[model samples]
Target: MDFILLSILKTAIAAPVLLGTLAYLVWIERKVLAHVQLRIGPSRVGPHGLLQPIADAIKLLTKEDFIPSYVNKFYYWLAPWLALMFAVTAISVIPVGPVVEVFGIKTNMGQADISIGLLLILGLTGMGVYGIALAGWSSNNKYSLLGGLRSSAQMIAYELPMAMAIASPLLIVNTLNLREIVNAQAGYTFGIVPNWNVLGGGLQIFSFIIYLICAFAETNRIPFDLPEAENELVSGYNTEYSSMKFAAFFMAEYCNIITACSVATTLFLGGWHPIIPNELGGQFLPTLICMFFAGVLFYHALNPSRPSDRLSMGVIGAVILGLGLMFQVPVVKDLAQPLFWFASKAGFLIFFFIWVRGTVPRFRYDQLMRFAWLFLFPAALLNLLVTAFIVAVKSN
Candidate 1:
């Protein structure tokens, strides 16, 4: 009973946070796009558009909630919540940092800390694609149906590579638990460069690349976002939605992006590992430092300035620090620096997402399907096989 109650409480906390963050991510996406395109976005809202998400939420909430006359009302209503729920649920098992002591209980930051974290994530994400497919089919509209079909095919194809790319890290660490994986990568030689899986052998690097490409596809981001190709399919699967229902779909998209970023952060970058040199050590200091960097980088990505600024350099600094902290071997007591380090790495990835969004154009549905099926799928499979072979050899 206690365990069940605790789990429910954690979910309650996480759901709202994830939902709220998704709302802000929408704001962040628009803000970053505006800066990229040389325009001020949502400045009319509170304080340089800080309150824009809130305002938008108000508008969405108050708008007329409608179901198309011909649509299956139950499925249409059920689909958005289903998507949002699955997207949010995946984040629970992902550990944000070391076990945080809340009150008397020493609980981890995330909901679950299972050994096969990757498998859990994969299964949950796979199930989420159905929501889009159902929404389209139930809409009773041709465009929505087409959009749903596209989404199903795209997700299925991309998932192969994504899983393959994910396998490489498992080879190096030999474990599926996210926290253990992060712990394996902790520590440094000379107070610089964290020992992340990215530093592994050639096969690992290849796997990382495959993972990244697959990530963009999995999240339906640029160069792979065929599900809702705004220009061609006329808003795709969500063509029929309006008001808060539309907002649910919008929130789900950004939530998936955030989840993908979190997953990549865990696999390649070293989940929540702070970069401060623990050998040169402080206690909780490193963790705090890492957290700070993580938070800042996260903010910066959401709200970036022009490209010419030295933000990239700062991001690199944070990544290094985070790696140093998470990789600490002897277990650095003062973890204040890591807070900054962890955040920095996360921020860097977020920056990359923004950069990709701005620079790369969306893919056509056919091209997107071909890339996933022909290229990414094979690459991911090859990478996975190689990783497994190397791991077997090393063990022998």
Candidate 2:
């Protein structure tokens, strides 16, 4: 009874926060991509396009829900929801921070903390592509069908290397539980270098690199985004989708990106652990970072990138500065610090995704498959073998 209630409470808090983040993530991506291209993006929608996500949500909700007479009604209706559900569900088992209590209730940061959390995430993410496949098949259009086919093939081709890359880290951490995996990554070498999988702990750098490359393909990000190459497929499987249906797939893609980033942070980057030791004032890092950003926002506010940004930027800066101040509170700092570190690492990974999209060109379909099968798969497999051997020798 308590478990059910706690789970429900966690979901209540997390769901809205996550949904809000997803909305702004799109805004962030656009603004970032715009800056990369020397353009001002989303400024007209709201103060610096802060309201753009809200505008988009309203548009999607108010638009006519289009359905084609030629399409298969049942499956077409089911596809987008399925994709969104599976994508969102995968995040539930991820451990964002250590356990904490509020109002006499104690619980972990995420929805579920099971022993098989990693497998649960893997299973949910794998099943998500079925929605894409079904959408294509049900559309009764060659383009949509081709998109679906490409996605299914992409998932299958890349999953092998991804799984193998993931396994190399597991051999070092030796647990399927996500929380336990994060805990195992704690501590530093010589009181400086973190014992993260990508570094001193296990030196799974090759594995980390492989996992990231495969993640791009898994999420259909640029340089590997052949599944819905609009030029070739006329917007691909989503061509016939409109209104909320289209929005569902759109949200699913972003959610998947976030999920992938979270997983990487947890498994490779020492989830929730600061780069430096607490004795060295690791606890104060969050406050410092927030204050730093607050300063930047205030500077921008005063200088006024555009006159419209002065008030908005100043308001945002003040709020950020207040947040930095709050972290100094003893009680709030305990909870906020771990969450901050987790968010920072995950946020950087997410930004990397946006960066790659702006800089890299899309790969040809055959080249994508060939790279996954011929190069990534073999490299991942070899890394796993090498990691197992090292762990075995060290154990002996």
Candidate 3:
């Protein structure tokens, strides 16, 4: 494909895919959280709450766009849009898969193939803080301002650890390009263990762990979500916003979660590489898993606990079975395998975030800040130092 056309094609595909994912991600979280809490969630909106996001879109779009009389007009309006833009923008450089020829046109899976992908993403993530800070301050509400301040502090504290942890892998890969970082981790140790940053060959699990801890904070997720704690600040930094502006902040948070998970997949989880090598029949794993899940769904459909689920589960199962069979096609199999592995890994990380949210309680503002500076930062620094030492020794 022509470079410009491919770029446009990628953007066109990515934007809608992301928006759609953001919608369903909310449904996924709600359903998972409901199961965790021993409750049924959103059952009234479409089959199994599948259309809940559409309802949510309509509601948010129709809600009153009220601007507070006491607010700073321009910054208050800009904050959420700014938050959303930066959150979603970071994905352009992420390598979803290696370069491949699709339909006789060659291209990389990512929208961009920039040399400094890692650096650029890090910078973009750092800049996302401005939105929160501005939203709180511009609201002219005391609690909102405090919430913003806490977020700023939390981010600053965790960022050092995250950057240091990221550096450990950088030293091992010897490149700043995200694609190169992933490529460096291709293949395995003794044809058994995959060379992911968190696994045997790379052995940067400590750094990966540190990075995850910081990731939770950077994305303002559970246990580190002091800035948005309802009990503490009553909607936190975005308290004054209404309608789509509020929804923008809401969507931005999820976008950041997805972006953070994607980065984790790229940096430490081998991007789109299979957890098991193809020689061991890893290529067939996705199809098998998909079929297995479909079977489970079919089983549930036969003995469904909910009346609605009887039909919904069967329909869902049939769709998944169809997808599983499609993965067996020769050409689709090649391209599909890589995308499947990438989605599975990234999907697991995203699930982990939701799982944590349903189970973990928010941290005290003071405790959150202290934990980041006192523990995560020092641990990351040590991990980076040890990684550098090992890589240097191996070179010698």
Candidate 4:
């Protein structure tokens, strides 16, 4: 059947892309943090370290897959893969763009369009904790046990605020389906600003802020990254893990970050919607951006900072320029623009994650818990109540 084939096709395309993105996200984080500290990151492996991920992958694959004598081998072996599976699975229900016709067959951009998509994400993410907890416990290390317990507690504490913040938007839209949540945020107000949940319809800016804060905690990202605190926990739950298994755990964390950003983009920022209406030249924005980057690349190519740059940079610049020109084609524009907007919004949020890591200090354990329960939980709860009241009044 066409449906089954399409599903297979989507999975094939999305899975590799997601995996590659997870790998590069690590490179991006390092480069960003390095620059923030006035240092160059990985650059020797390949051009500007573009091949760094590949090199790292090879290293991880070839390294010793060590197991501690004291640990439970079965559960220790299972944890990283389990974490990765759930992280990647959450992407299934997230629509990256509107429905489009390709090769005369209509298909949704995402893999699945389940009705209870939000609930599925929540359930899977909640289950991801089992991987971390099991990893720590099975390692039979006191430090790993402490780290695992901390992660479990942190997830439980922050999930309450995160769910409440998510609920505030659901109250406004009156839907549990992720696509419908995005569709409800389609139009603009005053023909200029988008009717996104954060801006127009829900005006749930506080909710958005609360969601982001909780997201940081939920993903165990810095200022709240106590689980893997190197100095405190000696690399935390995966301390006993090595080689490819360790890489799997690292990949899962970035994958979760990507999922969090994607969810936020879909729920609050309008998933694939342009910032302004298409009629207002919003469609041209991507072309303009690509061309601008192309121009910059060409300029650098001409300048030739490094000896190798004259050839490599010039070729890359030409390729970018060609892609920019391709966006002028009506068919290409139609197919690619939605993806562009979705990527832009999600990319910004991803950058924000890295930015926070570079600029913010890690929270002391007690401080992290206190902030989530005392401040974030109450704020999210109040926002949800107010949102419900407003929705009720408006419906009447």
Global lDDT of each candidate: 0.75, 0.92, 0.90, 0.90
How many collisions per candidate?
45, 0, 0, 0
* Per-residue accuracy of model 4 over 1-396 as CA lDDT, tens digit each: 388988998899988998888889889999998998899999898788889999999999999999999999999999999999999899899999888888788888898998999999999988898889889999999889988999999999999999999999998888888889899999999999899999987798999999999999889899888998999999889889999999988988998999899999999998999997989988888888888988888888889889888777878888877877776787777667888899889999999999999999999999998898889999998999999899999999
Q: What would the TM-scores of all predictions be?
A: 0.83, 0.98, 0.98, 0.97
Best model number under lDDT: 2
Q: Mind giving the per-residue lDDT tens digits that candidate 2 earns over 343-367?
A: 9999999999999999999999999
Model 1, span 254-369: residue lDDT tens: 77777777777778877766454545553445455556667676566556684422465356547755754664434433232344455556667766787788889887677877
Q: Residue 64's C-alpha lDDT in candidate 4? A: 95
Better of 1 and 2 by lDDT: 2
Model 2 lDDT, residue 380, Cα: 93
> Which has the better TM-score: candidate 3, or candidate 4?
3
Candidate 4: residue pairs that collide = none
Q: How far off is model 2, as Cα RMSD?
A: 1.0
Question: Model 3, range 1-396, lDDT digits (tens) per residue?
Answer: 577988999999989998999999999999998998999888888887789999999999999999999999999999999999998889888989889888998888888999999899899989999999999999999989988998898888888999999999889889999899899889989898999888965788898888888899999999888888888799899999889999999999999998899999988999899988889988888889999999999999999998877999999999998888887898887777788889999999999998999999888877887788888888888888888889989999
| Ranking of all candidate structures by their lDDT, best first | 2, 4, 3, 1
Better of 2 and 4 by lDDT: 2
Q: Candidate 2's error at 354, in angstroms? A: 0.6
